[model samples]
Target chain A: MESWRDNRFVFWLLSLPGTFWISLFFIVPLSVLWIYSFGEKTGITDVAITWTGQNYGRVIEPVYLQIMWKSLWVSAVSTLICLLLAYPIAFAICFAPDRWKPILLLITILPFWINLLIRTYALLAVFRTNGYVNKAIGWLWNGIDWLFGGQHPFQPLELLYNNGSVIAGLVYVYLPFMVLPLYATVERLDKSYLEASLDLGASQLRTLLSVTVPLTMPGIVSGVILVFIPSLGAFLTPALLGGANAIMIGNVIETQFKSANDWPFGAALSFVLIYATFGILALRWAITARSKGVEF
Target chain B: MAAVLWNRTPQGPLEYSRRLWLKLLLFATFFFLYSPIAVLIAFSFNTSKRNITWQGFTLNNYVVAWNNPDLLDAFTNSLIIAFCSTLVSTLIGGMVGLQLWRFRFPGKTAYEAFMALPIVIPEISMGVALMAFFIRIGWLTSDVGWPLNLGPIIVAHIAFSFPFVSIVVRSRMVGFNVQLEEASRDLGANQWQTFRYVLVPFMKPGLVAGALLAFTLSLDDFVITYFTSGPGSVTFPVKVYSLVRRGVTPDINAASTVLIAITVIATVLAMKLQAPTKAAKG
Candidate 1:
């Protein structure tokens, strides 16, 4: 078959619009941000390119570093929890009847399509003092009190506006990202291997740990990347669900651009997130490459 | 002994327990996913002003949302932005996908990596980046009148959304036979004619799916839109976010339910369109 190179005019025509649009609108803007990171603020509305390292220098300050560390901790916790919950769900979907697969997959992905703001708002309704969670617990407490003929009063558990709520929100939001990739890998798994293990007198737990987990490592990595990166930079989740003390790196970056008016510092903070993302991706690539080398 | 045991019964107590555990996990996960949405939808009809308790059912919230001009205007802005961005991104991204698939070029790997950057990076970074770009270019300044409207938001939406379209389109082209194009050419059809009649028809499903995805993403976007939008260009999500900061209201719930319904419908349609291709590949 003739290559598209045989028709250079047509190929260039096809490529020009997309290349131009992405370069101008996408690449150029990100480049601007990169430049801003190295610059300094001149005035209230003016950021001159003074070529200073102060912005990045401030990133290592205790206040900013603490926020960044907290962000990492929260994201890692959420990603780990998402993996634990999603693995079993993915397995169940694979083990389900043939006709039920699509429906199950759709159900897993449905919440993903819903607006993030609305989902967080719904959590507020469910976690507030007068929300459904507290209401249910109160009813249970009253029932026990009546049974024991006691006068103990029930108090609502503070489920909202905390670090725990922020982590819960992240897990709730990114669960589908973890499940979908796992489902794909688990579905494509060779069942014969499991049968062989079982036939060889391996326990179900042992077989799962030895065979299934190793085989599904790719999905686990992809899911972790997908869930962790977004959770790290999550603004709306921490903003709406978290208390005043629950500010993450994303919230700090948002403040710089909005009320703080520190565009140069904000740009630097944003670059830190970008760098972290690149590091994780590079780590994944190295691991995959090493595994492939071993196989060969 | 192993063969005899296997033949006697395929099911063991451990397997049974494992299956039960998986099923319970599945049930719990689904409940976790759907319960909040159910509560949100249920509260849309509550007559309570503060949404703290259920104060009987009424359609008044939907009426109030409909009557609010600002909310309606924001919804209209969202629709316009979603429509415009989807159309432009689908066109540009379709071409890019075709170019990448059909030809080998210098810097192709670099270009592909660049395209994926928008997707892999944090969206907050993208938002701040575009805000800085617009400010630097003077388009976002208070003095700029003509280019200071919805143009920047639409541009940002296209930038982020087009990569998704390219990915979907390129994936759909995998393993596609080139013989169809050769046969059309041999039959004396011109290049444009063959492209229009053969290639476009083949790419119809991907194009539709990509467009639907782009549209849904643009409509659902809040972070990027919030940064790029001007005073007069508030989209639905931005409007909702501001209202949520003030306090949650039933009208917001009504608006959210409507958005949810639209997204569900669009997603179902896109899935239906892509289902046949998946089955064929299988």
Candidate 2:
């Protein structure tokens, strides 16, 4: 083996380009954003470094707090629904026959290849007022009316441009991110252990709860993180599917930077979002570590 | 025989119901996953422009999208940017992957955590951060002269895309057997020759997967491109977003269909290339 010192130069040379790019594009900008959060915007396009903390204060106000709460609530509900729906499917895939397993997994993951924008737009095609779903509902209602000699036709349900649709869109987009990890964990589970449990007179329900659930905790956590963080920061889905009242933290940030032109306040709002994300992740880690009796 | 009968008789109907429940769950999940895309693909052929109501089926939307000059230009820009960014990112990411796999260095964990930050960070935050960085550094608004153009967009794409490439390539490299490299070197091969003849072939699947992933990501990306791209640098997704915001048009659906088709083809090809590596791992 080559001496460790000799490889050091090669390491520096190889890593320099990627490191430089990330630092310039990611690190430096995040720092700049942090600094900007302290500055005050003096004019339409200019921000003066005032070292004031009012921007942070503004973010914690009742109105902004309400938005933040709404964002969190929506994301939590979406993540919960996705987990409920994905777990069963992942379980099925884990136990599927050899001939059907790959196909089932592929069907679950293939939607991820499509662009999120296109997928959301597709959701619109289904949820729109005059869309296919409402059309079917109208047809069914008309059929009932004809049979019962009703005088009036049924009106379409208001599905699109609502908070419910927004959450649905989020769940639809993020289900795969939840499923793939859970599938891997479930598939790699020790079958012998499960069989042993069954042989010892443990019921399937007991084995699933006492053994399988505990084993898959890591997958469940990862799936939650992957789904929740993005859902929290979701902009496009809420914009397209949510009505006037569906603004989230992401939309506020976008509005500040793009329309309001308040870069400093925008930066402050972003810092809050960033901190919230890190805080949630760290809390989860700490909780998991404590439960496992492991040093974090 | 007693145990078998005991197993069969203990809540027999319950077991059957559980199995049926699982089957139904799988079916419903698949339906939810695919129905939106199926709807989009089906509606791309709809003759209705303003409504989702079925008119007579027609190929006019595809023809319209094809003939649209602005959409075509956006598509061209996306292709060029994706190509250039993929090349640069893959090259740098490959080197980084090699470095990460081969060398033991001080602060390696720190370096890795830093590398992983981008993947975990929200895209909007990154987009805004990069946009702010561009403006603050006078990359976009220099008193001397304007430097921001397609250059910043390409740089941003490389930044995001390279991390993915590095992760994929590095995962493969972790499982790589170093004996093959040593044997190649022992057989009178120079450094370049060893890399060319041994490492390249070993890394072929990973490299292809990384390249395809980077290409699709660059193509599908909207948030970063929206923030970083100047007036002349609108990509296809950006164009699609704008069209979508204006109204639901059949042309957008047609464009989306084309985009979906390309990504699906790339994904299939990547899966085929990756199958061998997966089997080897198993």
Candidate 3:
């Protein structure tokens, strides 16, 4: 079949608008940010491109380093939790009765479409000091005291404004990102392989560990990257839930831009994140390529 | 036949327990996913202002939210931004998708990779980058007239959203019969007429779905909008964020419920439009 390359003018006309828009708005801005990463702040409102590494140098200072470390730790923990929770749910959905699959899938995706801020706000309502969680716990405590005739009053547990709450918020918001990729991979998995393993005398647990997990490695990798990257750069979750002590790298970058007026430093920090993202993607690509080569 | 016979056999105790456990886990996960939103929705009608405890049902929160001028203005800004971004992104992205589907070109892989960049990078990076770009170009400064205001925010949204539209439209073009276009041309139609009459109808479902997706993305966006928007162009999410920082109130809950309802309706409509195509394909 002849391609649209035969009509070069029409092809250019079709492609040029999007290309030009992305170049001006997306690529040019990113390039500007890249240049500013090596710049220095000259005054209260002026940033001079002095080609300094001091901005990146400042990133390794103990204070900023600690925040970066904490961000990685928090993102890793939340991503791990998302994986553990999502795997079973994805597996269940893949194996669900045909008629129920759509409904279950929709339920999984609906929260994804909901606004992230609204969802985080909902978490606030659930985990506040006098929130529903404490209310229920307090009620249970009263019931126990009534039975035992205790004199002490019930104390509401402090569930919000901490690292734990921030982690919980990340896991909540990014769970669907983990689930959808897993569901796609698991749904495409061959059932006959599982049956063959069972017939070959492998226990279910053994088969899952040795066979199913390996087969779903691509999905696992994608899910982890999706959840981990967002959690690492999460601003609202930490701002709303983390209070004072749980500041992540994202919040710090935001501070540089908004209050500190350190555009150069913020641009440097943003580049660090962008580089990290590229590194992870490259690692995934290399792994996938190696695995594909092994198939031959 | 063997598979049917195996399915008819009774499950052992271990298998039965495993199945039960799986079902329970699925139930618990769903509950975890949904219970917070359910609580938020329920409390939107709470009579008390604090929203710390349940109170008698009232519609006053919604009434208050409706009457708040700042909230209304922010919401109007969001709608205007979403509409403009959606329309432009869809048209530009649709053209890109069509070109990608119908042609082979040099450096195609690089072009495709560049298109995916906005999606792959963290949004904060994009937000700050755009902000910096606007400032560097003097578009975001107080003195600039044309490129100032909501222009940068709208541009940022279009940059992020058009890639998604391209993806959807391209996928919709898969397995599309090119013969229809040939037949239309043979019927004495010009290139413009063929596209308008033949191609547009085939691409309608995808276009609508992509538009809905873009609209929701723009409306729900906070980070990009936060950085790109000037003081006069505060969006709904930015307004809500400030309100949240001040303190949680039932009216915020009321506002949130309305936003959620809009998003859910848009998503469901997009899904409904997508469902028929999948069914037909299958």
Candidate 4:
């Protein structure tokens, strides 16, 4: 049993380094961002500051609002796909033999060590016009195309650089984020409650819904937070896979900082992104508590 | 009853279902994870200079990327930067982790939250801020006596890497018992002796794991390095990015294949070293 004083001293000391670093870099910079959000971008090539809320007002404009909507939609699509993909995997890993479970988990982790850029580029090898996918499709449609000579069957799936590809990219990028937390939760699940339900003649689907799913809701919520935020702020997948058409909030932020000469507006956008992130984290905390039946 | 289905007669439905489905799923899952790397390795040997394809096989791409002084130098810089970032972050993060474990203090919750903010906050924000900070601070400016180069790149790399080391180490440290420290004190050992003999031995695994993670992160990082770095500090990822933008060559694929091989090897070795601790946790 430790005294209050001892605990306080330890925490203060332990926290000092971290606090100092964050305050210097994260806190001050964010504060600057917050303040800049209120300021105006008023210069030609270099933004000169003049404070105003007109930047917030412009967020209501169709262009900015549409960008926000697109970001939300892409993030939602990715989150939905991740949930569909991860639930079964988590379920499978849980039921996997103890000797093989860790090995499977490590396999999922292999992509993280592989360069993210390299992984994204691998999509190129498969989806390229002359790649295996097209070649295989061409094999199926070769007779028709060869006969017609007008290029009807297997025209190489001109489906690249659109919402579908972008969605696929998001799904591929964030799938692991969904898996890690879900894996942690499922691994610790008590099997007895499940068995008792089955013994009482509950259907497989019912047992999953009533016993297993609700029990792992925390993992789901955390996974959503993990996947949703990154997808919302994503730039790489959209830029590489989607096109100029598939810009998101993060791309906007990058443009403002790098080229648009609207630091104040950029700062404002970042503040909004930051606030949205914090809002989600807070909402997750609240929802998790509520799900567990906590009053607070 | 189902046992008979999988017997020597090959009629066992239940045993067949269990074995077949599980094996198939396992294979599919591993293929999903690893097929991308396999594809990259295969493509690296593609001989066609225009439009990537397997035009028979050749190691010419590897020979080219390896022979290029610029790309090889970038790879060396990445290695050096990752090593230094891991070293510094490990030291600082270890100290912070210990302090958290050993001493109780006010504002601890605040500290914890502050530390975690970096993880939740977008990386681009950090990049922009570091860039602005570097320009404002004379040390990074080319006009200043110091050159714009690897020094600033390393500083930026270590900055984020430290927090990771601290976060992982702190979680482990919190669960560690204080009895060892008390026992060491009772045995009349000084603070340094107690730490070096007792505390450090226990913390060795966590520290190493955290450092390895930090190293990989620094090596992989691009956005932060892009903003903070000068002409001389180009990392492997950035080099790859530029290569890709210039219409990706087979050499890029070969270089990437080498990188993937190295990372997998390193991660496996690190996992093997940490296996006992991980098993104990299990």
Off-target runs (Cα >4 Å) in candidate 2 are: A1-4, A143-152, A287-296, B1-18, B141-148
Question: Best by DockQ, which number?
Answer: 1
lDDT of 1 by residue, B153-196 (tens): 89999999998998888877774778998999999999999999
Real contacts recovered, all predictions: 0.72, 0.62, 0.70, 0.32
Q: What DockQ does candidate 1 have relative to the true complex? A: 0.61
Q: Which stretches in model 3 have alpha-carbon errors above 4 Å?
A: A1-4, A145-152, A293-296, B1-9, B12-18, B143-148
Can you write out model 4's per-residue Cα lDDT over A1-296, one digit (the tens) per residue?
A: 34447556545655566567657766665666676667766563234456788777776689988998999998998899888778777777767767877877887767867667777777655666766657768787987678878477556775457777778777776778888888888767787788888789897779889988888888888888889998888776776677687888888877887777677777777777778888998999888768883121
TM-score of 3: 0.95
DockQ-better candidate, 2 vs 3: 3
Report the lDDT of model 2 for residue A71.
Answer: 94
The models' CA-based lDDT, in order, is 0.87, 0.84, 0.88, 0.74
DockQ of each: 0.61, 0.53, 0.58, 0.42
RMSD of each: 3.4, 3.7, 3.5, 3.7
Tell me each candidate's i-RMS in Å.
2.2, 2.7, 2.3, 3.4
lDDT of 4 by residue, B237-266 (tens): 888777765675678888888888878887
Instruction: Compute the lDDT of residue B194 as modeled in candidate 4.
Output: 86
Which whole-number lDDT from 0 to 100 does residue A254 have in model 1?
93
Give the range of the ten consecutive residues with the poorest summed lDDT in model 1 chain A: A287-296
For residues A60-80, write the lDDT of model 2, one tens digit per residue. Answer: 899999999999999999999
Runs with alpha carbons beyond 4 Å of true place in candidate 4: A1-16, A42-46, A143-151, A293-296, B1-29, B138-148, B174-177
- The lDDT ranking, best first, is 3, 1, 2, 4
Per-chain TM-score of chain A in candidate 3 equals 0.95
